[model samples]
Target: MTDTGQPSTAIARAQDSTALACQRMGDGYPLVLLAGQANNHHWWDRVRADFHATHSTITFDMRGTGGSGKPQGPYSTKQFADDVVAVLDHLSIERADVYGTSMGGRVAQWVAARHPARVRRLVLGCTSPGGPHAVERDASVRRALAQADPEAARRALTDLMYTPAWLADHPGPYTTLGDPDMPAHARHGHLVASNGHDAWDALQGITAPTLLLHGDQDRLTPPDNLPLLAARIPRTTSHVFPGARHAYFEECRAEASALVSAFLDEGP
Candidate 1:
């Protein structure tokens, strides 16, 4: 551990030769935090302490995001999932719980399904299976995520993330927590990968214990996903945060943290 008690950072080379930026910290059983679409390890900057206090937590920038190498091409959730296993192998973490949000949740699905031995448990928030059963929000809102202007994209996403009442009150830097920098090319890759992701058929293959958290009011990938996920995964638990929106984890910070921390601490 560093002087600040934060995890030491490093880089791990993936199978495709792309360098993945990572942080492996805390103590006890490992827990990896996977950020949503276009977001990076920094997504956990505010909440890292919650998980790290109990588990040997790990967070990393997915390919084409943050400090990770950006190869120009359409990426797939399977490739992203493989990148995660590569990170575990690099850090020598044979088995660990995986928590992923939004698009990261989709990636987590692939991880637990394809490499069942590597993942001990799975936690998914604000995610979807991305096929015929999935529901989509407004097209303009989706378009805003990849808007060329950072400020514009952030503003658009901010409106969609938190509830109107919450936004009216907590007006400050906290708003920027969910918005990470995403270059145009990187945004393209993320959109392509996430848009093409379809884990409807793969959900039943997940053998690990699972938790699905969703916001009842989420416009991006609403509470409907929770039931879909629960019905499919054999061993699944779910919680729906009432009145919370897309960023319910942030909107209901303390509650979300406490619930997640407890789940991670409990043995599989």
Candidate 2:
């Protein structure tokens, strides 16, 4: 039912027994959507429908999250970057527009640096370059991530990801956190990988046309961090959405997607 002539969803292997599951939509220039930490492909559901209209959009569950392979962590962003490449190779896509958010944004940096030839353009949303140079996570935030109770951790993280107004308005959605379904180990792996990742140095070699979008009120990766990305990557443009938090796409999907779609139209 999809472009691959298979079912709407399919799993592809990158390494031995490590299967990366993905769902494809549209049928034009490929646009690979990499999700954030603790999130699966569903994170992009709202925007994919819009993106699919122009670009063939593919959103995948990163290794160890969602339906993807969950190998042990202590994983690096570079390894996740490799996973993106594997997906492209399996799907026979020579090049793609890469869009990543938060942790996924870090992986996108790696992909641009390591496989510049494969990336047509790059978009980093509400994320950082990482390393000692990158802004560190708040101590209380970090502590919450280490909490034993996963539900409590999710609720705490939601606070950081969403603004107060959004949270107040979306009680029903947020309430699901009490017994929501998510791979704890995969989420843990994401935390481990993110903590270990620092791709600040790699940005120097990025050749793709890049756009960095950050929510002005992002607590997870704040506006202060924008300078790190803007300063390092050559030919990079950025947009800071007012009142938006880490979940910028969710908070401002129409505005965010329009900016991205227009950028993608310009090409490399």
- Best of the candidates, lDDT: 1
TM-score of every candidate relative to the true structure: 0.92, 0.90
* Minimal lDDT window, size 10, model 1: 172-181
TM-score of candidate 2 relative to the true fold: 0.90
Candidate 2 whole-model C-alpha lDDT, 0 to 1:
0.81
Candidate 2 lowest-lDDT run of ten: 172-181
lDDT of 1 at 164: 76
Which segments of model 2 are wrong by more than 4 Å? 1-7, 147-149, 171-184
What local lDDT score does residue 89 receive in model 1, on the 0 to 100 scale?
Answer: 92
| lDDT tens readout by residue for model 1, 1-268 | 5326667899999998899999877777889988888777877766767776768779898998888998896688889999999999999989999999999899999999999999888999999988787776768767877699978977777877888798888785662344356677887888889888889898999999898999998888867878988988889888999999888888898999898888776767
Each candidate's lDDT (Cα)?
A: 0.84, 0.81
Q: Candidate 1: lDDT over CA atoms?
A: 0.84
Instruction: List residue ranges in candidate 1 displaced over 4 A.
Output: 2-5, 143-152, 174-181
